[model samples]
Target chain A: MAGSDGSNGSKEKSNDFANELPSYNAENMQSNMKVIYYSRTFMSIIGGVIAGILGFTGLMGFVFYFLVMAITSAGIAAKAGFSVHLYFDSWNLIILDGFLGGLMSFVLFWTFAYDIVHIF
Target chain B: MAEDLVLDTAIRDWVLIPLSVVMVLIGVLRHFVSKLMRTSSQLPDPKIVKEGQVIIRARNLRAAANFIPLKSFRARKVYYSNEENGLLFVPKGQAQNAQAQMFSDPNMAMDMMKKNLSMIIPQTLTFAWVNFFFSGFVAAKIPFPLTQRFRSMLQNGIDLSTVDVSYVSSRSWYFLNLFGLRGLFSLILGEENATDDTQRMMQMGGFGFDPSKSLSAEKDGLDILQHEWALPKFEQRAETVLRKLVS
Candidate 1:
């Protein structure tokens, strides 16, 4: 019984150490990489679309906004040693994003949904 | 005879100009009055969504393991930790059931949070958006050179996040997901590639917040203010807790 208790203690310690590691072992890095890749790609696409519409001025605005947002978000990611997406885990992001996204939603509603409203 | 002739011509010319000016003024006044009446009659103020609630259904409530109940109750000032998404409820009670049961059998405890979260999160998000637009967006768009100041003032004026979980099905690690979108996003994205077994285990049941007694509206408002004021101290507490648990 004593020996079993000792083994359990050791196993627990090992488990604790496992949780604190910054990166999943080499095997798991690919999965994490995919998340980061997708987030950055999505952000880039949005930024590019906005830039195309804004012209040179829009390009400048995109660069400026992206730099500020990226720097702030990346700093947070570094401090947490985690990806940016995890910050949204709190559920607060949905509100923040929705409010911010409301800009797009409004534009979409005006352009697409307005016709439907008019027709109806 | 010459003085009378000069005076007559001057008066006649001034009369025509004044007549034109009066006509223009009347036209402008009429337009403004009509516009004002239309504006007043047409636009109703958008309904002020001062209060709203969200119901987030948990996919799995039965999976959580921890269900420890606290004995004593002390309401801690509400503070947000990006690491821990939701407000911590630190009951000043006997901390017995929490430490062991929460650590060893976490799944049951997590289920409780998941169940309550499904209910709490949706409402909180909706109210937050309504508040954000009416409060933040309006303030930011105020046409003035000092708009940024107004935005900051408005931001400081209201507390955006207020979350309370009355009854969770359990009390385990799943509750850790409450931190924020960024935090949850990080967890989901990072969990897939997590190499550290220790971190994975910690995620399982090691990290959790102390539950607190519910506060009244006045108490809750004060708590938000106190949280902003005591933020540094609260963060230190979190860092210490994380260190002790992870190390």
Candidate 2:
């Protein structure tokens, strides 16, 4: 009721917008942030433990974490029918944010595992 | 140089492995519990949904305005910028009133409270249980060296001055496992499983309460959107691209 005349305006604008950006779909663009957060956390912890088992320390440990993350991302991509492009595009939140977001968890687990396995 | 203390294999079997397993089990349990606790969000009013769609359509037009023909771009610009007929031209102060109403909505407040309770209850219980059963004992040592600055953080609950900073108490180990067990949960529960502490922490930090922020942002964006058409130069750009291809 506020924009009775404007409703027609919206119809026109919506058509123009649709024609221009045919690739962008709001429903398809929606990524589950909760899932991405959990998966990234899991991957980073696993990566950290692996790095710890490999006896990596300091900056080398972080480098190892990224390596493991890349492998994990590749595995996820493969699991999604090898449509790496589509998966990365749709799930960019996880693919991009997951890299640095899990660093703290990686370091924590890596250092903990290193201590338990090698030192103590 | 710090000295290395050789811990027996019995400590690994009795303390370290059990602690790790317990942490993972708790994480899996928390995931299922939280999932059970989660309630679906209530749908917004149809009026609000229509308003949101109008703003979204305007934004989409702005982004893709360059691709359309000049006449089409101008039509959208005219429609959006007309004070009487513009999709976003609401009655003065109406947006502010709606925003205020949303900010004070009690249902939103209740949702936030419920989420906080879910995260806090599990976390507090886990912390208390770990501290009660596992306090006072040095369970494991960190392989790396640290300065005296980390003595308080790494050696929590242990009051001994002679104990190495590398030696972590059981409570600290539990804390470490709490933060680091996301991957094991993922392996067992699959991706996006609800048991992640990091996500809960992020939610607690107010990252989850974005509806109001986004609504306000949408209003601001529509208010400021410059409808300057980009399609007038499209033919020129297309010719240049074709020329480059031919060359």
Candidate 3:
């Protein structure tokens, strides 16, 4: 969804009158959302486990999660041939949503793993 | 006000490990079961397909309307909105009739039923099994401290008031793993696996019942769309863009 406006701007500037601006495909958008949602969930869980094992807690844990999330997003962007800007209009939204969405799972796994490793 | 408590290592090995393992195994099994149960999408009739194509074309025209000159835009708009010969225009109430036909489509109904069955049966079985075999035993302790309010929710079967709120019972642990194991499923089965608990919960929340609801919604959207000629403003917008680029 990023760079869509840029793409539209360029399309308008181009002299090809017959060239159609790509319309938003709802089905394609839904599938992309599913991919990002699940992938972010998966990454957050793993990241939480790692953070817990490293004994990160409170604010540090949140910071570590964001770091991991950035790497995951970069990896996804690379896989998509640097088209993240095309697929996602706002990187901030993705990060914010991923952080909030995965908080519960992260906390659950992090607490359990932390206790099992350190307390026992 | 509180006493220090110690949980045996044996509980970790016997209870926690086994519960986690069983939960993961069940999740993997459910993934495969749902995959096997998935029915391929049925193709609509040829007439329906043709009608869909017309709608798509009209949509594309609307999206690219600014690209064409105003005269051409008007011509295309007349071609679509013309009462007598428009390729995309339908008779009054035809949209409603199409939605009604889609609503009663047996294939759609069957697909919804299959999805519901796949989601419900495994969840029921897992809950029953956990309750029957592992109920009343505390499985694992949460690492962080919790207030006394969580004691009843986390320690479901155990009646010990002295027990720490962090010590969760087997049933609660099972439920936790139910939602927490999504990452494991994604790792093992890939991102789009059918066993996603969140997706199932969303479905259960009534979003997944009727496919025709969305279809009708799209139809309504199309019906209400006005044929605004974007080409008239295209020149002005292009001039501003050029000015900005030069600046």
Best model number under DockQ = 3
In model 1, what is the error at residue A75, expressed in angstroms?
A: 24
Q: Cα RMSD for candidate 1? A: 27.6
Interface RMSD of each: 23.1, 3.4, 2.8
Clashing pairs in 2: A35-B192, A42-B182, A42-B183
lDDT, candidate 1, at B199: 55
Candidate 1 CAPRI grade? incorrect
Q: After superposition, how far is residue B204 of candidate 1 from its true place, in Å?
A: 11
Of the native A-B interface contacts, what share survives in model 2?
Answer: 0.47
Higher-lDDT candidate of 2 and 3: 3
What is the clash count of model 1?
A: 57
Tens digit per residue, CA lDDT, model 3, B1-247: 2665666778777777787788788777777877776646666567666665666777677666656776777787777766676675555544444335548787866766887787788888988988998889777777566799998888888899988788789888888887777666776776557666446657644323432333344345445655544456677888998999999
* Cα deviation of A98, candidate 2, in Å: 4.9
Q: Docking quality tier of candidate 2?
A: acceptable
List the DockQ of the predictions in order: 0.02, 0.28, 0.31
* Per-model TM-score of chain B: 0.17, 0.72, 0.69
Candidate number with greatest TM-score = 3
Instruction: Name the 10 consecutive residues with the lowest summed lDDT in model 2 chain B.
Output: B204-213
